[model samples]
Target chain A: MKTVKAFAPATVANVSCGFDILGFAIEGMGDIVQLNEKESPGLEVSSISGDDGKLPLDAAKNTCAVAIQAMVEDLGINPGISIQLEKGLPLGSGMGSSAASAVAALIAANEFLSSPYEKKDLLPFAIAAEKIACGAGHADNVAPSLLGGFVLIRDYHPLDVIKLNVPQDLYCTLLHPHFELKTADSRSVLREAIPLKHATIQSGNVAGLIAGLYEEDYELISRSLRDVIAEPYRAVLIPGFYEVREAVKGAGALGMGISGSGPTLFCLSKGKEKAIQIAKAAEEVYQSIGLGVDVYFSAINTDGGYVLTE
Target chain B: MKTVKAFAPATVANVSCGFDILGFAIEGMGDIVQLNEKESPGLEVSSISGDDGKLPLDAAKNTCAVAIQAMVEDLGINPGISIQLEKGLPLGSGMGSSAASAVAALIAANEFLSSPYEKKDLLPFAIAAEKIACGAGHADNVAPSLLGGFVLIRDYHPLDVIKLNVPQDLYCTLLHPHFELKTADSRSVLREAIPLKHATIQSGNVAGLIAGLYEEDYELISRSLRDVIAEPYRAVLIPGFYEVREAVKGAGALGMGISGSGPTLFCLSKGKEKAIQIAKAAEEVYQSIGLGVDVYFSAINTDGGYVLTE
Candidate 1:
């Protein structure tokens, strides 16, 4: 087999209205994983650029390593492997940075050894790795990063992950502030349960969001892309949250919300120009709070993860 | 303006898994409303057919009358209106018979005055008229029957409604048994609250349903369509429910669930062949139970409400 590599983009786990179930991919905020077969019986991983600290050399403790090991167990293939991860997406920022690394590593590893397993087949292993990090397996991030576009994880007798087609001219403007809200931390802060009214409103928004994506009506899409269940509770943790959302709204953005948990605030705009405008306006709000911010202008990633180059 | 008439299809409120929020239109199951300028400030309603003695001909009590009344109140227009309604859909059969009349009347009245209000502007009155019948201001049926296609009604604020494009081969087989499940009665039977785990599963299916619509994968669509929230509680009212669903599934139906409330069972199939197979199989079940059956072999309705032979 020829040498192989792959890239899975970082995904915003909850696109406002869809909490724990809905997610979309951002183009540039991603990690690239490269894999090669060797004459050994185990796995190895190394962190390249984009990550601040050295990734664990041991394959068992790291997210990427755990995912690969789980896949090996599933396929019962004892092929020796080595992987290099180009971690571009930020970690611990609700934007599913850990999931990107884990998914990319697994996709690369499985593909390099010949895809003996389907994408959905590998969800449990990937989710298990996520559980180790976030204390639970929420497929909101992993599914999108692994499969691409907007993914729906239907947890049932047999779990199903489905992807939605995003319309054209829709762009995501992402702003990560100088803070990190770990998934575990965010999950802990939330109430164990919520009011019935909140659930009803949230469910209504979920229906509307799915419909908006199908219809591609920007105005309605914006209006429907609301997170009444989680955002109101989670937003309180993010500084300058309302101002940033207001700025994005005033800049002609369709919608704005905290990406995943918090610290990173993102908005959807009509085009690149509007995305940039929204980003600039959002940055000013972030700066007002004396915080450092990183901005990304991206579109809905239709193609999520695959062998980009070999 | 030339004399004009409009027909809107009766929709299925609570499209199986999506109760009180999601709905879709059936092409031939609705009421036709016609309005023309008359000399006096009079609004007359004449029910032509298919009421089963359930319709009120009174201008104040008729569904069409109530909708037109609300429209006139809001518009403050004195265009003397002559309204004619031909109710094609069965009354109080889980199908949104009342909403069809409501939306159709409002649309005819709007067009009578040469489009006094835009379609988006007509939602409030549509819901209000629907309220006159069901004693609730819900848009699950009105939005789709008025607009068309799969719809999500997220928020009345700024009115977030999105129309999703259903797949080309998305065939639906509906089985209507001779029974009545009033919206109020079915709603009353449901628990005011639901189990959290059960809610999570349903949310996953909703996510999967939306994702399945986008990706155009029948397998994913079917898998993502499990209903854990309401179907279990509501499916009891329909006789031969389990047998119909099983027979339909045995006939290679992709997804199956209750159409609206009771008696009518709808299943999504891969194509016309499977739809026919499921329909035939389902009809046999209903016949064996000695019940009246009306079956529709249709697609996801794209054109909701429009003028009929104006």
Candidate 2:
């Protein structure tokens, strides 16, 4: 049997003003999936680890297996494969944990089958995995984690995804405070209707952020990275969020916002050293409140998911 | 007396997906303002023409005088300036008629004072002009007309304006039907609240448009040039709005939307010739309904307001 190991980085969705539409991948931390080719014509889960026994061992119920199943079905070729899962990212830390797993598995499976699909072609399979894990097939996390850099989901119905320009010096500090906020619960706190004025303000900020990124204007990005729609209501759900935000701003962070759906927060900075400094500042705020926190500092992941050789 | 004449191009505001925040200036059509230096202390409106006696001749009530007054007040040096207003743009045509007048007046006045401020510095005075012409002091029209390109009013509180990059081959076809839609009356049709889904969709499209413009992707721009919030309600106010849109699309227009408010519409195209074709197609729609229409074909006005040699 031939075995291939693959890795896909975790991602931050929403990116402040671009809620439900924008996301980007981070380096150094992600999920790893190992796939082994077998002679039998079916899929199976060999083992799972690093999830504290929280993930299912059943292949039919797992995110990686589900994604590979969809891919192989679409290709009309059922290759016998066994998937091994290792969760480097927390399950619901607002850091695209399931998406990373599905992406990693698909990458390894495609390599095991001698590469039949391109990187972008793997998006729909990862999105299928998201449907079962998060109850909605959103591609904000999946697209970025699959293709790398910043990704914009322009429309969901037609699945229009655009890869945006990433600034050369941009770095991110992700603070995962020890708690999980369910995506569904985070969504429930929002009102069905928002003020027309707030909507216009949010769109203006979105345009500004996109322009800022392309022009490499950090100050403009700082001014435009605001969430008028989601943060006001979701802030109360995370304790000490405002305090940490103030500390991050004081630490020379460009901008700070809740990463995806809560508990986890991201601070954008100009360089790697600044990102490290921001991470330390954020850690201190959580430590003062007697809460444990995990910190990750990374420039953007430009290569996305890739195979690894033993 | 040292006399100076200036012309400022009219602008198209609310360019499809970017309602209230995005606008671009058009070439060829504008208002002219002539300022004559006099040996007096205060401002005076000497004569007005081309308005059919509809515009006020009072220096305090006219848009041009109000803008110059604010500029002189800010400069703290009251130059005796006799203003002559020529209304080349029609009133309430949704083609930024008032903005052009204010910008042209400011350009002429600035030249009359031997240029005290940069072009961008004149935005506040133009905004003050908008307050008297319309109920609100919005800069979507004023900024573009003054800056001479696609401008994004990122935020209004501190008055942040960003001039965006324009695609070189982009052209516009503006159709002004024989009617008037007051800015206040057009605004009254909208609701104070909108669905959260609609807001997200709008922000997504705004991001797409900004990215598309920067990347020069005509197809992406076409997909993003859709207005969901205001157009649904405001479209009914324009006669044969849907019919014109369909015809414009059939003529290979990239996109079409209400320019500023109503009574005038804009269709974007790849080049000047395509714009002319789209204009003819749109004219057919209005002509079949027994409505008279005026057509203007222009590339983007890159040089906004400028002093003209008489």
Candidate 3:
């Protein structure tokens, strides 16, 4: 075998108040992308899996291809590669499946070529690929994947990335129902105008949440994570939002919010015990609704995106 | 000289994105409230300066009186005192003169009474006083003065306060143009609704700025502090905000924003040299506009409100 393959975990974007700027990489999810260094000069995508038999293998229009070419062009490495993708995450699930593919392929290619680009440098490549998937350039999913942990993109130009230390006790229980929700479509249902009062309240929560993160005060963190603006408007799209939140909140979760654009509900807890409880509660809600549930009780992935089994 | 006196600096509330929650204590640029302990009951505020006209000697009406009474009540100590108010900071200049007087009086009273109330207990008393001044309750000024650093207020119930480690290199140059803009009146001009686009973009900035604060990145901090939402609307109240920002930006300052409200512009810089330069630039701009300017260049007062002199 001329090349090896690896998987990138799915990520939850918007992580509460940080829409289009905050995201967390999840474990046990997402797609696997492969890299093959052949005698041929060009790189091509060979096979694909999961994705319900949909996603293109064009290798150019594909999100994974864009990230690979960015590395190939910059490093000037002539490795003929036929990449195969295993799209484990649902397409358009608001779980950053496309971004995972792009990031995984980029990580694999960069690692195979001896890592010519640093993690943060993957932003441009990720954004470019994400633009094709979302019709606009956004950094929410890509940044968390490439750099891992919680990242803040201060300046997209010089690429000022701040890597925040996730509190050690944070555990997330993400439940994605058997429904698909496109980020663009979900965003369209939002209000064109939000009342100033709601905005002010939301801003207070944002500040409070940041303060909570800094202090590592779990109670305050839970209280400050309340959303009065976007979640209310967007939660209407997710059928089980209310039930899942109520269930998890009763099951010893700190707080919960719609991850990214929705259908996926995420709850934070103090430990694996609480995480499992929340996950169990979430699965019950989904089961009651007669829908499939994929739940994971993983801590935040500290190392966002990197080469696996290298 | 049986009693001691000192001035607590006026503060700028809602420092950018931290509305109704964040504040910064400004030194040598607020009201001077000197307290005299008397062997009498209740509180008496007699000495008043700066304003030529009578300011009503009613103890309840006076900001210092309200703050002192609140502190005494909260501390469960009924100590008679006389507050001498020499209003150094201009009223309605968006410099939090009322808050300063309250804080200064509280500090003096607490110290004079053998310090029954600790620093942690100052926020409630200060906020109660601010309620009388602004006709509402907020701890922006009082918290910073009491905490003596950049504070993040998570919740008002349990009163979780987090003191952030502000970068040592960060300095603020405030140019106070001799003008008045009431905080209440300025707050009334906000539109009832904000576009969702603006809210999400602001969310991104909030995330980036908070993350930047933790990382202690000055450049990223400045970049993330950009306020496109509130600043645009509030700039209308302050004449030449655009001009001051442009002038200071050209002078190598990182960023500028309305300090609390209108008239006082705070430009942030990394070093003292740049701070001095920015100060000179702001002064020139104010002078060119035929407005008197008082410039103060100091670091982000990490030690907020404490016993400066005995």
Best candidate according to lDDT: 2
Each model's lDDT: 0.77, 0.92, 0.75
Fraction of the native A-B contacts that model 2 recovers: 0.89
Tens digits of lDDT, candidate 1, B111-179: 777787888678888888877887877888889999988776666665566666577888878888887
lDDT score at residue B107, model 3, on the 0-100 scale: 80
| Winner by lDDT between candidate 3 and candidate 1 | 1
Between candidates 1 and 2, the one scoring higher on DockQ is: 2
Worst 10 residues of 3 chain A by lDDT: A152-161
Q: Give the interface RMSD of candidate 3.
A: 2.6
Q: Residues B1-310, candidate 3, lDDT per residue (tens digit)?
A: 4575767776666666655556676545656667776788789987899956446568998888898888778677787788888888777676676777778787877787878877677778778887888787677677776666676665566676767667777777888887777776677876778897667666556656565667777776677767656788888888778888899998888788777766677777888899999989888888888878888887766665545365
Q: In model 3, what are the clashing residue pairs, if there are any?
A: A148-A304, B148-B304
lDDT of 1 by residue, A119-204 (tens): 66767778878876666777888888887887777662455666675878989988988886666666666665555455656677
True contacts kept of each: 0.52, 0.89, 0.58
Clashes of each: 2, 0, 2
Interface RMSD of each: 2.5, 0.5, 2.6
Q: Deviation in angstroms for B175 in model 3? A: 0.5
Q: Comparing candidate 2 with candidate 3, which one achieves the higher DockQ? A: 2
Which 10-residue span in candidate 2 chain A carries the lowest summed lDDT?
A177-186
